[model samples]
Target chain A: MKFRSMLAALAVLVLGAAQAQEPIRIGSFLAVTGGAAFLGDPEQKTLELYVERLNAAGGVLGRKLQLIVYDSAGDAEKARTFAKRLIEQDKVDVIVGGSTTGETMAMVPLVEAAGVPFISLAGAVVIVEPVKKWVFKTPHSDRQACERIFVDMKARGATKVALISGAGGFDKSMRAQCLQVAKNHGIEIVADEAYGTGDTDMTAQLTKIKNTPGVQAVLNVGFGQSPAIVTKNHKQLGISQPLYQSHGVASKAFIKLAGDAAEGVRLPAAALLVAETLPDSDPQKKVVLGYKREYEARFKSEISTFGGHAWDGLMLAVEAIRKAGSTDKAKVRDALESIRGFVGIDGVFNMSATDHVGLDISGLRMLEIRKGDWTLVK
Target chain B: MSGRTASLATLAGIVLLLPLALQNNYYYEVAIQVGLNAIVCVGLNLLIGYAGQISLGHAGFFGLGAYGSAILTARYGWPPLAALASATAGVAVLAYLIGRPILRLRGHYLAMATLGMGIIISIVIATEDRLTGGPDGMPVPALAAFGAALSGERVWYWVVGATLLAAVWLALNLVDSPHGRALRALHGSEVGAEVTGIDSARHKVKVFVISAVYAALAGSLTAHYAGFVTPAKVTFFHSIELVTMVVFGGMASTFGAVVGAAVLTVLPQALTVFKEYEMVVFGAVMMLTMIFMPRGLVPTLALTLSGRRLPR
Candidate 1:
């Protein structure tokens, strides 16, 4: 039996060698530097590292992966231009990576027109709302984050809430989405307050939320350092009501920045953060642990869910290419849409003709900061 | 050919021949961006290079033009061309009003004033979520004529290329005119220009308005071309980049401004192959160029080609 299995493995390797050919070109444009670097930097690293690993493991469809990344620095025009370069000049078979909704939306027309498959890592509903044929994304939209938070709120019996958001693009978009869906979620936004970008403190806004009567929970709908400051201020003001944050602050840096203030704060994030704690029976355990181990061992940095989005994006493109058995753009696009129950770092995606994002609010696991680390909330 | 005709012919030749060198849509996209930046830099050259005045808020006027055209065509349902014209005209009037008062502040004070103005405009665009779409920005209606949308990189290359040539011709003529000499006179010394019946204040305001108009027109064209506009274009960093292009290409030289815009526009795209070290290499290149050719790219090269000895 051992000898028979060895022979089978040798036969498969030989067949794979025969099928292997040129590298399957994957072009990506990300905001790898400048203002949105937090999102783009990790994403770039994930793509580069995994593509190298896949190539070493005999690649997808016996063809190696070639990833060419351009940093757009969150500039929309540059993103559009880079998309053109990726399509027209690089002649990439598949494209993935857009770190901001503005960048993703800017490239939407060009990719759709050129008949290229693009999977974005940005967060926004507009990219897939009308459901353009060629355009898709990996990151859960801001609406999904809002809905997931509301589910937790509903479970906790929180009816009245106060919304405090920062004046950044993601912050405002998430704030708007939460407001749009609040009534449906059975949550009432009693007080709505905002702060300017680069504001050192958010205590004044926290004070107002605290003063608002019957405010059962205070939701901070923002990302980056602002949310951290919001968390810190919520603790500073000693408001005991549950303080929930958006998926924007899912990274470990949030806990480090907010420190002890982050305790008991709940936000929606991927299960990859608590990979070690996940049961072996969990479907995501294998892939999540593999990704977390590879990234941590290689980069020596704490993993961010932003990087997980890129991992899902690259792997999805690879799987579609494998399913199509060729680099044919249309076939690969169809394969991507038809992919069902494919577990990824983000979620178990089941893409369809109408729903390109695939992962719903359920994909985003509710995680709470406990003892300065993410603890999966049951 | 005369100096004016020679420079214009050289610019026209390159613009005509650029398409052949462009292999595909990607090349055309980069070329289009270069042309747009060149047009704005030409106007900026007139202000900083020839007139010796400074504007750190130049991008504010550019942003206002973009947002103005975007809102008018997309939100109000006006025609694209009409929106572009109105936006440019509005910015010109605004610039005139602003220039009359702020032009009086000489040197660093004027710089500070313009910088503050730019910050204010950026903030307004970022905060005015109802109209400007806040920091996330808004999609713009494409420039169309007679029902056909004027889209695609190939078509835009010619449009922008032709517009750039026309702008150069106008600038070349204006620079050689008495008004041009008046600008130079004021650049030398405001009191000296006024003593010679140059009406330094009037000339300063006129050139400022003209430059602002140029920036506004380019901004509107950019909005329509890309079909998107963000407050990112209106930021202080953008203003600094524009100024750097004017200075880097060689102030007071039209061809230099075009070269600076072209090289800088293409540099970042070309440097992507460097991967992790792209920014470091980019910064190093800029530093070396400034150190080696202190007079900027064009003037230094022009001086050498003419076999002129160094003054010092």
Candidate 2:
């Protein structure tokens, strides 16, 4: 009888422990390999650091945070499959992932169907446009980036622009947005040319744009080596027009790839790139610099805007969880949408029912490359 | 059962049992992808393995079918079934037109021509922003039949699985038929097949058109299943991957093609948990498999198990 009583007490203790230790599961899929590894690697590192910090601080709502990550390798099909697994198999409460626009768009239908809150890190307008009920993103959309660039161009008295875009999804979207929003920004596109992603020499396209009349500025829309090649080719061709690049090339790697040619080339980027330069009174200054310092210190590498995206996504989800005071998906989504004036490393997020991303044009800062380093335009 | 019948039975058994074993939506989704790829590989095997023709542009046909159906059903409001049928027919016509000229070229020339064809198609799709939604791709509508929208991976699993089985059965029967004999003759030697009263050009073009239709059908199913279509699906890399599956499974064997598709589709997904080591492991696994099983996985395994050469 005494042994039976002891066993019952042990069972009670186990059940109580299980109930008390129910962790908040956050699942993510990133392009941690393949062509988009630069974006995903830093995002993965940020999530790891954030989760460690959050858990060490006694977690959210008195329960530990559990992070489950999958490597998508920048494949849309892989992203879709991983999204399903995160939702159906892992049963995660929240998801933050799809480090590229293609991969993020692929997971939209699945996330919508499952009714899970998805915080995307991809920089595309389509991911949040028309307002997916459960979907949100951290990075400013390509459209926003275009608007920011055009606004800066207008301030610089540039009226006509030449567009040299790479034939990739991000490039295509930015190119379309540039054409669509140019008139509104009082900018006219004089010439539009495209090069393949693998094209190393864009001198021919740049020459055509250079010959076009009324082209005051040349804007290149692409990510990775293509933009760098365009920069090099533009200089090689000796085009006197100022060059503007899309936010897709917002990294030191692009400057490094372009070498001396990247000097004076301007692009709009997240504030994290110039965190140290932000005014002390700015709300996002401390958060951005703190993240950059911690990340660089821990990983022994410079932080990029891509990692800032992951930081904003994780913090947003945690904030929503705390506000909702429960692990319920619906409540968390509502809380996410209702979050206002939440200063994150990306921007001061003010989420609403219609605006999922919550960042405006002010979120992007005009940056120019100076001596192979990023410098904020005053 | 005969060997052919036994293989068919085994395939059927696998198709029926896979869903039961993998009850989650993710597994069902992966299974559906395997089935779609298997359908394409089965047709590609017939062209590359049986007919002795090299096509580096099958993904062009796949893309044509996807964009065709997506544009029709999503934009033009045509019925999904009609769109699928018309897309398949269109791809067949396209294949026939291109095949007549390209099939006449031999060896590397033929390979280059097909490669050019694939690249041209993808470029057109990528550049034509007004129609094809440009490189950002466009969403596809859900496939509906009998007034009910087909949603969920479970439903697609059955549809895609049955279609794959039908494809395999048709390929097997074709392989055993007189046309199959003539193609095999051509594969052995084009001059010998012509001497034996086989019209080599006619058979080559016919196989090309048929394989394109197969790829088109698979592409249509995939677009509807994923509910999105992109030029990435029609790129040179995708075409190469499809051809590699056929070669990796053992050319000319219908079951081999299916097995090849299943393995290649599942391998990367299975290795995703390995994170940074995933690609390294995947490459190493593929290299090891190729090095050890040079004749392809199924035929090599069959040879090892039965200790006799299997007829191709």
Model 1: per-residue Cα lDDT over B73-125, one tens digit each: 99999999999999999999999998999999999999998999889989999
The C-alpha interface RMSD of every prediction is 12.7, 10.2
Q: Worst 10-residue stretch by lDDT in candidate 1 chain B?
A: B267-276
Candidate 1, A134-211: lDDT as tens digits: 998998889999999998999999989999998898988989999999999999999999998889899898898899
Model 1 lDDT at residue A302: 85
Instruction: Estimate, for each residue in A1-378, the C-alpha lDDT of model 2 and write its tens digit.
Output: 234335536855885687677789899999887778999999999999999999899999999898989987787767888898899867899998889887888789888988999999998788999899999999898899989999999999998999999988788888887899899999999999999879879989998998998899999999889999999999999999999999888888898899999989999998889888888987888898899999999999988889999999999999999999998999999999999999987788999999999998998999999988889898
lDDT of 2 at B145: 91
User: Which candidate tops TM-score?
Assistant: 1
> Native contacts retained by model 1, as a fraction?
0.60
Model 2 residue runs over 4 Å out of place are: A1-20, A203-215, A232-241, B1-3, B307-312
Highest lDDT against the true fold, candidate: 1
